[model samples]
Target: MAGKLGRTGRWAWGGLLVVPLAVVGFAVAKPVKVLPRLGPAPIFRLVDADGRAVTHEQMRGRPVLYSFFTTSADDRVGSVMTRHLLALQDRWSRGSPDAASPTPLLVTITLDPERDTPARLKAWAERVGVDPQRWLLLTGAGLAVKLVVGTGFGVYYETPPGNYDSRYVLVDAAGEIRAVYRGPQLDVATVAADLALLQREAAARGAARLAYAAAHWFACYPVR
Candidate 1:
């Protein structure tokens, strides 16, 4: 009886080890990559350059990359963010279009809404030569913009905006904020990688979903 009990204990331990080993393998191999779910995106209703109401509900099924900018000419943060996003836009557009996945939207919300009118935004979009359909330049009421930029995104904003930090929020298709990127420098490749991972994670199902879920838990994102 003692011998039989010893054998059962060893088997139980081996069974436990198998699951852990598999988990370790999954982490190391990283077959299906995913970005961590940050939190629920702030509910917002802002207008675009075309004077159309662009609400959170409208953005529900599409991934949106959001940046806050001011019309201030000397705004260095804005310059860097603008260039980075333009590069991303070019890169994304040049790639073979994927009909299965929803086309991503790039949004730049002006911090100086008092002056950054819809017409101003439209002119800026044209000046930059960005595809107006894919990239939207947005401006709205002062209180509304403040609410979305400060309360919603938790970024600093003051009138006559003197140098707001460069930050980008990546909100996923299901209306969840997946990643927040900060700093003056932008890595287009890494951002591209993260976006790809997000699109893949969104379409994952069955065992693939489970693996992606695991990656979402363990991975810090921008995983190759």
Candidate 2:
């Protein structure tokens, strides 16, 4: 009986060692690098360019990218970001083999809704060659826009002075804000990588899912 107990102790120690070894291995090798879950994205309800009501609840179960831009004929940043996202199809699809749909939805919210009505947004969409099915340009009452943009997203948007910031937010399928990109220094590649990480996590299962959870718990983020 003593020998049996000693063998059991050894097995227990072996099991204990596996966890630390796994943590160390994850830290060193980083087989999975995940974007830190920032927080829950704010729930919002607004109107799409087609006068259709869209809500945060509606976007659940799908990864969503959100960008804010005031209605401006000269604001090339929005169009540039759109073009970059469109060009990143191959990059997003690199590892997502079983992703029911590899391409995540893009949502662009207009800051100047008072001037940019549904008709104007549709026209702007056409002007920029935006695919309405994939990308949604949204606008609503000025107050509602302010509530969602300023309070929810913490983005600054005001007219008259035309002072605003260029930014993009990456939200996971679970409606969690995983990553945020801002300023002129930010590029699409960084967002793409973080988003790929999110998508991979979404489609992961079994041991792979456990590995990703371990990666997250261990803070095994990729070196940037």
Q: lDDT by residue for model 2 over 53-80, one digit each (tens)?
A: 9999988887888888755766666556
Clashing pairs in 1: none
Question: Cα lDDT for residue 93, model 2?
Answer: 43
Stretches off by above 4 angstroms in model 1 are 1-13, 27-31, 96-99, 219-224
Q: How do all models score by TM-score?
A: 0.86, 0.83
Worst 10 residues of 2 by lDDT: 89-98
lDDT for every model? 0.81, 0.78
Candidate 2's C-alpha runs over 4 A off are 1-15, 82-99, 159-161, 184-186
As a whole number from 0 to 100, the lDDT of residue 116 in candidate 2 is 82
Q: Taking the candidates one at a time, how many backbone clashes does each contain?
A: 0, 0
